[model samples]
Target: MTTPLVEMLDIDKSFPGVRALSRACFELLPGEVHALMGENGAGKSTLMKILSGVYTRDGGTVKLDGKPVEITSPRQALDAGISIIHQELALMRDLTVAQNIFIGREPRRFGILDEAALNRDARAIFAQMNLKLEPTVRVETLTIAKQQMVEIAKALSYRSRVLIMDEPTAALNDAEIAELFAIINQLKSEGVGIVYISHKMDEIKRISDRVTVMRDGEYVGTVPAADTPIDTIISMMVGRTLSNETAAITDTSRNPVALEVRNLRRGRDIRDVSFELRRGEILGFAGLMGAGRTEVARAIFGADRREGGEIWVGGKRVGISSPQDAVAAGIGYLSEDRKLFGLATGLDVRNNIALASLARFTRAAGVLDDAGMHQAAEKYIRQLSIKTPSDTQEARLLSGGNQQKVVIAKWLLRDCDILIFDEPTRGIDVGAKSEIYRLLNQLAADGKAIIVISSELPEILRLSHRIAVMCEGRLTGILPGGASQEEIMRLATLREPAMEVRHAG
Candidate 1:
């Protein structure tokens, strides 16, 4: 048998208070696409980081081409023919594409930079990848898909033998994904070993030769992608067969409308959009990336200004000019980027939860009532099953799922009945996803109106009582709960031409 191109054995990594990886193992062969599969926080990324020299493993052995070598830094790893493209692009946006690709190693002569040589070299790399891009084009001017291609080009410029891509398709559309797959195939044909990491099941089955599952920082197993069923792979990742059974159908039509938006218009992103959230109903907003689901949610929550729209709450129209006004009107929004918008990471859990409702715990002299704040925080911490060492623990110390719960707890403390959760379970593990789903269901049963915006079709189908499908900033259609994926996708891709034809008739 040919020697594996890359091998990792008994890898272990740890951070303060967290053992991120334990005895993790992986192997990749030339001309094969090996997929690393796991839930969030399952140590897949940690193991990859160790291999790419982003993090030093406490204990492990890495072999490349039948030879063992120590990679102490990213530069060493790159010099040793390994390159990693992180989920988040690390390019300097202000620089040109050629400059970004040849950064830190620009061709020079007598202390003078060789601009012509740099562009010529970058253009050659682009041509090798069958990409049509101008080397002199500024990186900031390119679309996200184009930027991602640039990242791949940068990796190839190193003449890397082993390439690692993390969540390469998370933000791409169908056409863009097809283009990316073409590049992957080209690399595979050239005998470059590729390690692909993603959470999308269909993509794994389509692109990978083998799939390796990890659970709680431990290697679960590796199997041929063709032989392992997706359900089986998921079971291995989470240690249980997650039920595909949809939530029981509940009749919420009789419930009064808790919130309503009519003809919401916001430049080009939101146009003539309308939706209603009834008490005791989970109204799901479903669409592809940039399909205006988030825009509609933000407009309703007053996080973004709407040029023309009317919002009604509890059978009366209300003016919400800002987030504060929305909160005062009993509406709460959990942003998709929670670290930036939702919580104060530096503050303790108790303080974050009480931040929105501080007035409730303040005395007449304007002093904060610590006892009252702690009591309220503790009540919700237990009520929501938030796993925190204590209320005094910093919010940033908690896991992704726990941090999300803290956000939910904060809004609940504000006595808000209308909640909008955008990508609520993103970056959370499978176990924590189940918990968040249960919590959402419970909140709906308790008569709170809920709106969930998700890119994942399964999530939209499972949690929504009614799914609202958007396309190009318009409400194209609404489907009953448990609708098939095909139906939802059809509506999600519906365009203005179809609507115009129907209206013309």
Candidate 2:
């Protein structure tokens, strides 16, 4: 039998009020990609954190090359050939790529910073990875994909034999994802062991060698990624089967037009985009990165200035030049970066849910109606099936799925007839994704117009009543529900003005 590269046995961890991990265990062999999968709060991250020394394990035996080792801090873990790249990249935007690669341990000569040595080392690493990034370029100048590569290079700088990557491709486009996969293959060839953590089942099937399933802070089982069916793996993760059914395409042509945009323009980010969203419909916006889907959403929500456009709400052309104006016009936008725009992370769930309609909860002399706010918060919390101890729990304490629910509840309370959800399930788990899908369909059934913007083509296909594709900031074409993925990709890649923008009912 081959000696395992890493062995974590009987790991246990706990926070102030929650048991994060319980008797969890994992193993990794050299040159293998092991996928760690679970829903939010399922202890996958906790287990990895223990391995990477971000959190000290309460009870566990960590072995390297069959020899027990104690890892008490991140520095010790790095010295032990372990490193982790989190979902949120930790590179300094103002620093150069080379500088970011060797941040604290820069090459020094005669008490002076050795820029030449730093660049030379970074260049060598990029060459080894077959990447064409400039070492001298500022980190902020690079795209999210390039920044992720920089993070990988930084991990390699530590001579890390064990690398833990969390949701590495959450923000990457197809081309970028392919490039990252190539780098992973190169690393595997060099005898590195990778712990790949992501909620994307397709990616797991493609890149992982073995899949380990965790649920509610306990180990479930491990299976061969290539041989195992995705549905089986999902069942292992969530302890139940989730429906993979596509959205039922209902006829909403007779419904009133809830939102209409004509000739919307905002530089090259958005160009002459037009669409009509009817009540009781879910219109999905599908496109590649930089295709202006989110840009169009922001323009319509008045988050960004539109050079030229007309926005009509409920048969009236509404002047929306700001988010406040959009909200007053019965439009609500849930941004892709929910923490940055949608929710006040520091506030409790009750306050965050009532944020959009605070006036309704306010009384004489600006006194808040605490009872009403609590009742409203509890109502949505129960209706949305949000898993939380109480409405008083801090928003930051909730998982990504619950945070998204809070944002939705906020808009629902605000009584917005038109809701534009940008990447609503970006970082959520498979089970949470199902819940979000069900909620969206329920909202549409209740006569709410919704616009869903997603990079994943399957998601667009799964929930869209009618799919709208964009290319280079222009509306390429709109396909009916149940359109083939190939059909959507063709329009997504069409750079020229080939098809006139129209809603295909």
Task: Give the number of the best model, judged by lDDT.
Answer: 2
Query: Which tens-of-lDDT digit does each residue in 269-376 have in candidate 1?
Result: 998987678999998888877789888888888888999989999999999989989998999999886876899999999999999999999998899999999999
List the pairs of residues colliding in candidate 1.
none
**lDDT minimum window of 10 residues, candidate 1:** 496-505
lDDT of each: 0.86, 0.90
lDDT of 2 at 119: 99
Cα RMSD, model 1: 3.9
After superposition, the stretches of candidate 2 with alpha carbons farther than 4 Å from their true spots are none
Q: Give the per-residue lDDT digits (tens) of candidate 2, residues 377-434.
A: 9999998878777898898877777788999899989989999999999888999899
